[model samples]
Target: TTCWFAPGSGSSRGQGPPQQFNQVQTTYFTSIEILSDLYKKKVLIDDYLVDAYIDTGSKVNIISYEAAQNVTSSMEPSNVIMRGFGGLHAQSLGKVAFKLFIDDLHINSCAEITTKSNLGSIDLIIGQPTINHPDISLVTTSKSVTLLKNNISDNFLTEMQLSSTDFISKVTLFLSDDVELSPGAQCEVDVYTDHELDTSHVIVTQPKIFSLGNVSYFIPQAVLTKTPYRLQVVNLGVHSINWSANKLIIRAEVFACRYVLSVNI
Candidate 1:
């Protein structure tokens, strides 16, 4: 058989520049069943650790109205309309931007906020924007998903296969240098964490009973900026006090967002 094909023809046999295919963005709205249980993972939304549904099939992220309110009161107007599995449609109230921490991956993500009824029991939905992030490399199977960054994977396994404590663990701060506090004096001491944190600001709380005893010192609750968090220690005792280097001082919860320092003076 003899065949003739045009170079610019929009056909499989065409040799010219192939027809450019414009990609259309797709939005997926989850059904009650899928949103409740499928691909559920614990992700840090702003500072709250909540169960977030991971929907790789969708392109846009979503958060329940109640969840968005808890994360942030500020919401920008959004005109996105989402379609569910069974042709059900929902209108997004607005969009909120927040920091999301998925294991070792940190994403400054924005999500459309819809009514709670639209999400059923789910609070957040992590969609392709997160899974296909430029900084992340994801591998998935029928029952599991793994997230990798820079070719290194550290327990970024499926939710069922990994424990929440593995990633949401507290960070311990240690005194960075030897410090001596004089009577009725206060000093701002620098503390170091074992590893870098995802968020720049954190809330540091003194343990119920710190290693320091009979020191009459007070470490106020404060929001500390990272890369060597500074803590204020007030020595109320009548004598001098010394804290050696690398001494455990206070601990900060991972991704803690709220902290207050009150002073009467």
Candidate 2:
């Protein structure tokens, strides 16, 4: 449960939308209790509490201007220029010191930004940079973030491929049940070759699934890519299906250019 605001309104002038802007604008209703806190000078900003958005695509942390004014009366200005869906907008490039409580956990840091928009109902945009550390697990569906302190091992990468003639609506590839890897291990699955342009439009799931029968798969072509793609599997389903080992393992990394394959999924 997250809501999105386009960087610019319909009135701004520039290229339509920014690249990789995938969220819908409709308000997302959820029962999850949102947490808040304040950060400044590497310390908590007194009793200020703010709601945060767990955005996976956002590369930086952002705060509303109203929230900033409530926390402090005077502060240094920022020079960072942030561009959104519309185009370019000025964002103060100053460090943020805030406190946030997720469930019973409390965290204080000096890494945050203050913006001007109302941010709809969200006060903070907890982007990639903030969660880059291994401790943060920003689960969008659950509207919660889990912060762990211990380091975890990385998982082995897995790849997948589908036949061009197969009309399957969906496919899931699963890894071995005993092979425990890091939670964020990079998984690459090649659906088809460049020459087979028609088959390149396949969709791969994130956090590749490795469950029942020690395999998972996905179907229905979506996009084309020349190089091997690193996919992330986001969910797990019931345990009733098994996969065949003879299943094709499409080449991951492609070098020289080749002809396109014209088959439908």
Candidate 3:
């Protein structure tokens, strides 16, 4: 709530008064709805697990001085001032570099260091500098974001392109009966759900590593929501799978069109 500019810190440009130069942007929403709607993830900054907010609108990355201290004791001197909503301002201690780990992928990124009070509950704010990195690709659905290490292969890019085409939402799906599948064999299994559908067109995301050891399924097909909801499940393991009813917990993604078409008769 306090705002103070560094005294005798401005530098002269020409035949004019000393002007402040370095500055960075930050956004802190006062509304609970807006704050809750932002995409949040648990990431590792160096060795510390941090609850981070992903803000695509921001141009710079930010971290609290307390967090930076735990990660590293060194900081490059900076005159950068963080400006946010309601004319709130905080003078930066300095900038620090840290390794940001998202699952198996990690990126070396630099962020402006400020007081913990200035950051509130957020330990880190990942901005466009890291999100827009050449090796990083962020694919966002209706309620989630997929962070991919883009330098690996073209297949990841293709998958991202497909997922980005639809507004996807997840729902728990229940299997109707026990099923068995041989190695590399696939079939459409009927599923049960509690969600009342607003749209018939749904794209089911393939289930990741299931609890069943060495068993995997692929069901990336578009299906209509009917009485007996079915999804094509493939067994990608070396051995056959005799999955029991209600034993395998799978998530189904329902796609809704962002636009509605109307025609005049």
Candidate 4:
């Protein structure tokens, strides 16, 4: 019953997967373009190797039902339901405690048995709860991945409660020169923090309009309150295009409103 969506992105809604043995959960998810590498890690589920995807957007870890069959742990009923592409809903089979290895990193995690019939060629989708272990810090850049066993930071020493998610707005994309995309051109979209670091991917299917829905961001109140300063801003008021590594790059700086990005050719 397990299936993979558009690489990185999954829908945030659910229709509901039903209960009963051999019954499939019709979890719906949309295609989300994600940055991927061969960083596939393997672990045994009843002796079968499950290559896991380290998906950050996923709030929970999911393992295919077949994988669960190989493990010895009993399933703990899960109330979690998921939404897939085209908005199909699927229910989870429950959860089981499992252990795996990411290189030398010993990962002990609980994985939900999903109704996803299969994960294509791979087997597991590792989500946040499994990767958010307090003792370790994981950082993956364009070239390298660094995992810290223990570290502390005072930048965010205090947790700020968010009042709402209205900081960002959704927008579409278009060429400044108005060039049409060739049939189905594949592209990846990454959203960075204000500093252009700490990247996250949003799935953009339609080439002409890479729409990121109302994605709001939160900034610590203290940083803005005590040390008020203007940050060096890029993409503020520029409509330009360039070629980078054979891929067409469109750059636009937009104000906080819904408008089509005019990437100049």
Each candidate's lDDT (Cα)? 0.66, 0.39, 0.64, 0.45
Model 4: what TM-score?
0.43
How large is the C-alpha RMSD of every model relative to the true structure? 20.0, 21.0, 18.1, 19.0
Best first by TM-score, ranked: 3, 1, 4, 2
lDDT of 3 by residue, 1-265 (tens): 2222233332221211122445443332221112444377889998998878777766667787778876753677665555663445555566789889975788898887766766777778788789899887887778767678776545755567543334447777877899999999988887776666655445354545453567665655444445577777777778888878875447756655442122111
Candidate with the larger TM-score of 1 and 2: 1
The worst-scoring run of ten residues by lDDT in candidate 1 lies at 1-10
- Scanning candidate 2 in windows of ten residues, the lowest lDDT window is 24-33
Tens digit of per-residue lDDT, candidate 2, span 1-265: 2333334322222221122222321111121123432211121233677766655555556666666555544434343434542333433434456655543445554433444442556666666555564564433224334443333211111233445533443443333222222323333333322233343344333222344353343332333342343333322333323323334333232211232233321
Best by TM-score: 3
Off by over 4 Å in 1: 1-38, 141-143, 153-265
Q: Between prediction 1 and prediction 2, which has the larger lDDT?
A: 1
For model 1, residues 1-265, the per-residue Cα lDDT tens digits are 0111111211122111123332332234444347334378788888887778777666678887777876754777554556662545555566889888886777889998777766766788787788888768776667676566844643443324743443754778899999999988989999887754556345455433233456777777755655667888888877788879999887776543442334111
Candidate 4 segments whose C-alpha is farther than 4 A from its true place: 1-34, 44-48, 116-118, 146-148, 151-265
lDDT score for residue 59 of model 2: 55
Q: What pairs collide in candidate 1?
A: none
Report how far off residue 239 is in candidate 2 (Å).
36
| Candidate 3, residue 126: lDDT | 81
